[model samples]
Target: MRAALPGARTRPSARARRERTAGLAFISPWIFGFLVFTAWPILYSGYLSLTDYDVLTDPSFVGLDNYERMVGDPQVRLALWNTLQYTLLQVPLYVLVALALALLLHQAGRASGFFRTAFFVPKMTPPVAVGVLLLLLFNGEYGLVNEALGAVGIDGPSWTTDPDWIRPGLALVSLWSVGAAVVILLAALQDVPVELYDAARVDGAGWWRRTRTVTIPMISGALFFVTVVNTIAAFQMFTEAYSAYFGAGNSTYSNDAALFYVIYLFREGFAELHMGYASALAWLLFVVIMLVTAVQLLVSRRLVYYEGEQR
Candidate 1:
């Protein structure tokens, strides 16, 4: 080949440069926010996890001490077990209730919009407000839930007070927020081709058969989306539990049963001023969530159906 020309550099035109600058300028806020608020904090926390930092003092290096202590911390184990129980109870029930509600709303025809909005109203309610409402309804005496149960000659359990019933109470609280999942599933249901259901019916499939064979497979992507989202939310459960049992840092009436993992982390970090230890807890939780999500994705490979994929 001939030798290259000395002045053969090709730079972007002024218009192209201007367009690129404008695009970068438009996204600069998001970039800055992510770097400052999300990425930096994550990295800082990871560093802090290896130190013995109280907020009042500088972080002094303490390699693996926090991680070692975590293994023997009874409170951490309690919190983990409680959180696991809550997740186990909440996720499946939430999905089932959401799917059922979506199915009912889908069949409502003229009343569909009204019913959907009504169901979603509970989700729009603030978590604090929901906590208050739950306390009022589940109070030991003169609560509406007990009153209804009494009317049927069945005494309702003391939901908020009894440790045995605390997880169930929290489960009920979670069920109230299933409206968002229902709305998502409803949207997915609408997108599914009616012709598929019609074809299933023509092939002598009944309602259950149609749902299992057509509706489920068609909406599996949205189902998987909701499952993954709710799984993450369940793992990071804090606000509702805090508002319900330990608002304003008051741990009164909060039993070990209700001590969720994040609540324990909050107590250690802010209340006890063990910021470094709390950072370690946060990182551990992050790892748990990642592992759980990975397992789910692996399982979903066998279950979740994407459109246009070969059999």
Candidate 2:
């Protein structure tokens, strides 16, 4: 080989430097925004979680006092239990209902497109508006839901006022937004190979058998995605609770049944001004969500069948 040029290494390195500089230049805005908005806030919140920080006073370092308080705090326990209960109630039911709706609508033929739009209208509605509509529909006495029950000679539960009905009422509201998941599942259903169904039918698979094998396994990815997202949303439930009970100064009327984790965190951070404790609560919520998501992913690894991945 000939002797290496003196400038060869320098030229390649210089080109790399230029390319790196260009990449950095392109991403600098996002970097700056993330640092200023997301990363810095997260870091500062972690710091705050270890302190006794009221908005009005300087933060005093208190180690894990905030976290320790969470153990003895009845409200914290109530909020956590209530959140878990809501998650248990909402996520599975929502998934099942959405999947059923998708299945039904997907087979509607000429009416499928129109019905899809109608169903998706609920998802497109603002959360606040949905909350308002829910309040009206489920109002204890004069609400249309109660009125319908009365007409059927069945007394409806006091949805907004009674503790026993609070979570279930909220679950109903949550289910109304299942249109989003329905849309996703519907798209997944559309993408499923028709030949697979034909082959399954030729193999003497009944409708239920075909659905169990061909429909569900094939759409399992979308199901997994929607389930994980809904679980996270269930954990962070606040707007529905706030709208149902706390809005219009009705907090006093409603009991702890509706005091979801994020709702309580909001109360602590903003209402009580326990910034440090609130930060701790926020971090705990973050960890819980991450852990739950990790568990879901792990389980889905065994259950969820990707279209092309080897079993």
What TM-score does each of the candidates earn? 0.91, 0.90
Q: Supply every candidate's count of residue pairs whose N, Cα or C atoms clash at under 3 angstroms.
A: 0, 0
| Residue-pair clashes, model 1 | 0
Which candidate gets the maximum lDDT versus the true structure? 2
Candidate 1 per-residue C-alpha lDDT over 260-303 given as tens digits, one digit per residue, 9 for 90 to 100: 99999999999999999999999999999999999999999989
lDDT of 2 by residue, 1-311 (tens): 57778777533688889999999999999999999999999999999999999999899999999999998999998999999999999999999999999999989988989988888887877777777877799999888989999998999999988888889888988877888899999999999999999999999999999999999999999999999999999999988678767788675557688899999999999999999999999999999999999999999998899988987
Deviating ranges (above 4 Å) for candidate 1? 1-22, 248-254
Stretches of candidate 2 above 4 Å error? Answer: 1-27
